[model samples]
Target chain A: MDMIKIIKPGLLTTIQDNGRIGFQRYGIPVAGAMDDFAFRVANILVGNDEHEAVLEATFMGPIIEIGFDGFIAITGANMSPKLNEKNIHMWRSIEVHKGDQLSLSGAIEGLRTYIAFGGGIGVPEIMKSKSTYVRGSLGGYNGRKLMEGDEIPIDASKSKAKVGRYISPGYIPRYNNNNVVRVVLGPQDDHFSPEAIETFLNSEYKITAEADRMGYRLEGPKLTHVKGPDIISDGIVSGSVQVPGHGSPIVMMADRQTTGGYTKIATVISPDLPIMAQMGPGDTVRFKKVSVEESQNILFEYEEIISNIKYRVENSFIIQETDKLYNITIKKL
Target chain B: MYEKARFLPAGDKSLIIEFGDSISPEINKKIRDMYLAIEKSGLDGIIEMVPTYRSILVSYNPLNIIYEDLCHKLRELEDNLNDSGSEPAKVVEIPTIYGGDYGPDIEFVAQHNDLSVNEVIEIHSSRDYLIYMLGFTPGFPYLGGMSEKIETPRLKTPRTKIPAGSVGIAGKQTGIYPIDSPGGWQLIGRTPVKLFDPFAEPPVLLNPGDYVRFVPIDEKEYKYILKQVEENKFTVNIALLDK
Candidate 1:
């Protein structure tokens, strides 16, 4: 029964998990952490399930005071972090003593940051998720952002683990400001003018100020659709780059609506979604079109490597340690 | 006889079954029929199925069902949709306000159509709008039934944000913005009622295949209805019709 009290809630911080599923039918969007890769990595660093509850901070993070000793890890954007006025490195697990105050400044680079607890941040799950959908006022921290004087409870089971284990830089996700997202042709890509499609692939688009978790409205060359081809409304997915009447493309992201009527010229591949999530306004993005098969192969290879690494780490935990220094001679006897 | 349907790839995880290029009751019925038949067939790995005016978008887990197989299953189900169209539909009435801040574009609509605001409201309120399909947002009904006399183009340089409950007319169609979202539809009026309430058992006020009627109310009545909704004292009336 330990808790963390928020002394200063920076910019926009909210408790999130993988997001609320099974409620899309209700018109409720699946609102969760903007960067799932970083969110999951922070959880994995502390031996917690990748989808366990965690804190999703915007460009700026919170100043928190731990009420009890615990292990924590920070991931995603490189926000300078200090614990009790001592500088701490990002992407590594650290032990916190009770009464220690942790402060995170504005992100020096990147747009989002994930904070994960060893046992997971304790929050009631609504519709099977702790992610907050602020529009509907559903899920997470009373369906709102974390504020000053807010005290969030931590799962007591997490306190039993031995603290002070540090994560190395290798575990950290590197954020690239100039991102080139890989994409595949959408269903309605044929509806767009051939020249427009070619221009889309060849040009570099700048992320405009009109951006949010729902989608990023890009400002670039006008992408015109074929004269007689108007797309009807249909289901939309994250990473779908839709072109509205204005001729600008909006790349739908995590909090995007489930459906739309705009013609989608391209969809970002699943593997490159993490890189896109880290991008902020004014960032330039180039879209590289790849075949569906190639995109799937990339995703498959990434998953295989992740699983293999997890297998090695989980196996290490089960192996017994030997006291080799005490006995120089063979112990076959 | 209807035209042959085409299957297009929606994304890495979905497929769009296009009935045709145009909107007609025939195509709309086919889309709904196909959706119902596929849903009842219990196609494995089909996570969610959405129907629009002319196409049905089926979303499935790529890990569970391959793209080719999902379409094959859909084709198998499409053959059985001829008999499902006889099912009944649920019709709903939605009360709304048609002038003032709720509907700043009311006068504009009147001016564009060469009719008075009262006549415009009368024409809009009298017709039964068909729910083509829900899209753009959750529980947001894309209705089809506005007379050409009252139809108006969307606002130029669209508002950055339109509050939820703002009723709008865009081109030939009209829909209520169930959530406070950025949009370009010309606002005709607003409603105090919640078009979508997540806390309710069925969150969306109107479902696909349901008919909707807009009843104009005065400002005093709008405030009264708003309070009634907050206090859970409002009851929505409906007229069931055979498909």
Candidate 2:
């Protein structure tokens, strides 16, 4: 089995997949990659399934030593990845030979970055996922972050295609310090005053330093509530913008609890979640209200684009294979 | 009397069906009834249904089933909820040890209530509490039905870490910590039963709509039960509640 030894385990690196589904009824959180877009793209670049487990590095990136020949792709944030002290490109697959060293530094743009291998990480799946839930101490690499001197097992299966596959330039996501995120109002919009709702949509909020995989606590205008912010405890979904008595909004994330008591004023759409996840503590964010239909339409459009890209990549690979066969035939003649 | 149910959109992919405005047994029954009805409907693309105090959250995949179609199906199912054949609540007896080292805040609880430690224990153990939901942490039950006499405010500052199985009271709520986590509730006792075990099939000992009763035990019994639990020999006392 191929393995990668961690020489320096950056800030917080953990293995994550799409998420743990159908376990929230048991109070288990659906922990997965914070930036799902980057995770899927990285896997696709390396010829792996979209739901394959990848290493998610927060803020900083790890230095890994490859023990076997394989392909790897790094996506999401530009962490200035280097192969044997040489600069490498993001959004593309790179081949690694035995004893090659891959290192990455601090992020240049976004918060989290994803590193994916050709055959995914070989971690044992608990509850049908490899996503790490660090709080529960279950799933993914003994339920903990990667540390120095840790050996990460990589699946030995390799893609037959040559490495260096890259995503289209149009498909690459761009991040900025200021992001405008769209939301759909209310499971509990009635709890807040109309003025409060206006304030939530109009005002600018700064992501607090307490942001993590669980939730992002935003500091902004105080949203006054007509009634108390408390509600009968109910289920909370990812991107649910909850407001407590303090009036600031908390955007719940992948590792949020199964339920909460605070009133949720709005929920960020799935398509906009990657932008929200890429935001750092000092980043400024503004919310724009959209209807439920608009949110669903945006999701549909995003999925359509992803499928188109997949189709193009498959067609191009087939063309390259035919070219190679024609060259061999001409040489034989 | 049947209360009118309101369908509120939680997100693009999920909806919340609220039974009523307050937390009560009647509201909880409706929530459970709706959950069972939806489950039996065999609705495709339904991800999971979470039953809380007065609401049931139905999450689904938008790609598989649109929101309007799902809402229509759920409304049709709600009309037949009375005939959904909901299961009866399960009564779970938890073996607990009050005061001493296990419950560090027992003295404070007794003084706050102006009662002796034994009186506090008796009042707490006498009534069966209903499990409204499980959240905040894995298997941590949010229970209702603590008498007003034992009502205590949460700690001014939450402890950095509270041991699992510590029975606590915060306002009118009493619950057990399913895992070692930071909590603010005033601890009054400790239970030997494991509320959460990942190795178990269900992972949680109590479910929403279940009833729990605390059975007071001595320190010796606590140790014995703890040993039995460690060896997987202790079984939680469970019985079907009368409808």
Candidate 3:
């Protein structure tokens, strides 16, 4: 088993996967890759399961040395990835020889970037996941941030292919600084005054620097919610736009607390959360109200695309290894 | 009072069992009763059950049971709650050092209510608190019970980070910060024990429906306990409560 060694931890780097889902009941957050699509793309490029382990580097990327001969891919934020002084294009497969130096820099396009290897980053799994949750100190490299001198084991798995077919830009999520996030009215939307609701949907809010995996604090017109009743605490989901008494809305993210008492005006459609994950401080955000049907339709559309991509990956491997890439056409069962 | 708990859709794949509108102890009891009932029911498709101050959020697989079908099953399970028993829970005693840098805000609260620090400590430690919920952060318990004199508003601007084991008060509720995270609660004191340890047999030190009580200890005892904690040799004194 070969491994990768960190030379410099750029900004904030941590090992993450699809997160620990079963432990949410224990008050453990689902701390996973912020952008699931990009994480999967990186994993797929390296010929690993979409849910395989990967490095979720925040703001900036870390300096690493390849410990083995393997393939890797960079996705999510276009952080100007370079290999031994040679810039490498993202979203495609690249070979790294033993001792090859790979470096990632600050966000050239998006907020977070993921670098996945051929067999995924090998780390001790906690609660059936490699995702790191710093609050509870569980999962991924001992549930902490990647540091210089940390040696990350790499599975010595061989992947067969080069010049891997690229994912269409339409399939590759586009990271936009000024994005209109679509949301559906939540259980407590009526708590806010009509004017507050209008302002929430119409105004442009700037992301404050006090943002993290837990929630994105936005700066906008203060919203006064007419208390219909004191809401008892209940479970909250990711993308829930919760308004604390401060009148500012905090858009909960992947690492949000399991439950909350703040009144939620709306919840961003699940498909759009990945887009929000790539947003950084100073980014402007706008909200658009959509019907329940519309939100489900948007989610369904993405699911169809995701399943199609999975189909391609699963079948493409079979074809390449057996020389059946073109002979066998996929048919839905 | 509500007769039956209804299940509402939390998301496409999750359902919520709302017991009532208010945060009454009875409602909390019913929520716990229903949770235990469902646990005994051995219902399929439930991946997780998160109990809050007054509701239980049940996350299930839509592929196995759609939200509508799960709601029907939950309705069926509600009928079985009459036989549910309030089982005795393990009570954990926590040692605290009151009135110092560890508890800087204790004097402020005591003075506001025209009471002495000893009185405040006595009142707080005398009553048994129920763990209505465990949330806000990993291992942080939303304990329900406090002497009215100690109730205080949260700091105007929350500290960017509060160290784990810092006991704090916010309004009528009191909680301990289980991890080093940002918080707004008024600090009253600190505890030496780990409230949450992922590697432990049970990740959370307390669960909903569990009872907790604070035991006042002097600085010498606190230092002795701190050394024991460092050596991983401390054990909490527990008294089992009868059902």
Candidate 4:
């Protein structure tokens, strides 16, 4: 059984996939990759299924010692990945031999980074997902963040040893401190005064230090509500924008609770959720309103691009046999 | 007669069907009724449906079905919704031991209401509480129908950690904590029955729309049930109640 031994578990690293879905009815949250785009690309680059479990590292990353010959890809927040003390570019799959050391530094741009291996992280699926819901202590690597010296098992059943897969630079999203995410006014938007909704979209809200996988509490201009802040507790989704009595908005993310009592003003669109997740504390964000129809169109476009990437990664691309620039040949079956 | 349900789109992936704005049995029943309808609709792209106090969160795949089509299908289901879920809901009796170490806040709850601890326990355990929804933590039931006589304000300072199966009263509500987590509800008693066992087949003991009846037990009975629960031999006394 091949595995990656964590020599140094940096910051908050955990195994995550597309999340524990279809469980919100039981008051279970859908905890998945905060940045879904980077997670999928890393898996595609490493020749794994799009939803394969990968190492999601926040701020910094782990110092892992490979125990077998395989391939790995890094994406999302650039954590300055280094293989054997040499710098390695992200969004590309690299082949490695046993005993090779791979390390990553603190984030240079985005808040979280994902590391995908040819074989997915081999954690038993509790509730149909390998994604970690730390608050609930369920799923993924003993249901918590990776600790030092913890040898994470890699499911080699789906391992593909080939490498040299890279995503086009144009396709890789460049994360920045200032972001504008699109949102759709919600189930409880009527609870807020017209002036409050205006303030919410016009004002720039900075992510407070209270940001985590569960949700991000933003500090901005107070949002006035027409009705009281509280609602009969109801189901919560990943991108639901809830406004409590305090007037500040809280953006529910991957590890958000299954239900909440606060009135939700709006919900961030699916296409721009990756951007919302990548925004770190101290980062400022502004909202752009979009219709549900337009938002679904954006989602279709994004899905189409990923489908194209998956096709290319599985069929196209010439892998270089060696370090020489001229050793390119078509990928062999 | 109930008002027409409002269909609100929750982002791109979910749609919220709000039956009403109040927390009552009628609203909960409406939400649960719609939940059953959507579940049996064979509606494409609906990943799952969450029935809350007054709304149902329908999580769907945007790629499979568009928002307008999904809404149209849901409206159709609502128009043709059946009242079949009213076929005698189960009443799960949770055996509890009130006061002493098991219930640290029992005294406070009694003092706040100016009633004897025994009276408080009697009032709390006398009636059936409706399970509105499960949320906050896994299997934590949002119960309704607590008597105003035992109503008490929540702790000014919430406990950092509350043990699982602790029956509590917050305001005009009484419920149980399914898992060990942070909460501020006033603990009136503790139950030996496990409300939530992640390793169990269903994970959670109570289901939405079920009636919860707390049965006050003695220390000896509590210890007996505790041992049985630890050995996984204890079964919650559930019986169908005719409305």
| Each model's DockQ score | 0.38, 0.69, 0.43, 0.80
- Candidate 3: residue A137 lDDT (0-100): 67
Q: On residues B140-236, what C-alpha lDDT tens digit does candidate 4 reach at each position?
A: 8988888899999898899999988898988888889888988898998899999877667787899999899999999999999999999999998
Q: Write the per-residue lDDT of candidate 2 for residues A86-121, one digit (tens) a residue.
A: 998888778898799999999999989999888878
The predicted structure with the larger lDDT, 2 or 4, is 4
Docking class of 1: acceptable
Most TM-score-accurate candidate: 4
Clashes of each: 1, 0, 1, 0
Over 4 Å off, model 1 = A25-27, A87-93, A123-128, A134-138, A157-172, A193-195, A219-224, A228-230, A245-248, A317-333, B1-4, B96-121, B153-170, B179-192, B215-228
Chain A TM-score of each candidate structure, as shown: 0.90, 0.94, 0.90, 0.96
lDDT of 4 by residue, A87-206 (tens): 988988888778999999899989899999888888898888899989888999888999999998886657873566776678999998999999999889999889999999999999
- Put down candidate 1 lDDT per residue, A1-333, tens digits, no spaces: 688999999998889898866656545677788886778767766678878888888888899998777778888887898999999866656777789998999998898888887788788877678988776567888888889999999874664333333333464567777878888887788878789999999898999998888899998998988853346667677788999888889998878776777888888876777788888899999999887657666767766655654443333322124733121221334
Cα-based lDDT at residue A282, candidate 3: 96
Tens digit of lDDT per residue, candidate 3, span A188-274? 787898999999999999999989988999999988889943477888877878898889988988778898888878887777888
In model 1, the clashing pairs are: A27-B138
**Candidate 1, residue B66: lDDT:** 68
lDDT of 1 by residue, B103-135 (tens): 999899999999999998999898788888776
Which of the numbered candidates is closest to the native, going by highest lDDT? 4
Candidate 1, residue B177: lDDT? 93
lDDT of 2 at B78: 78
Clashing pairs in 2: none
Clashes of 4: 0
Global lDDT of model 1: 0.78
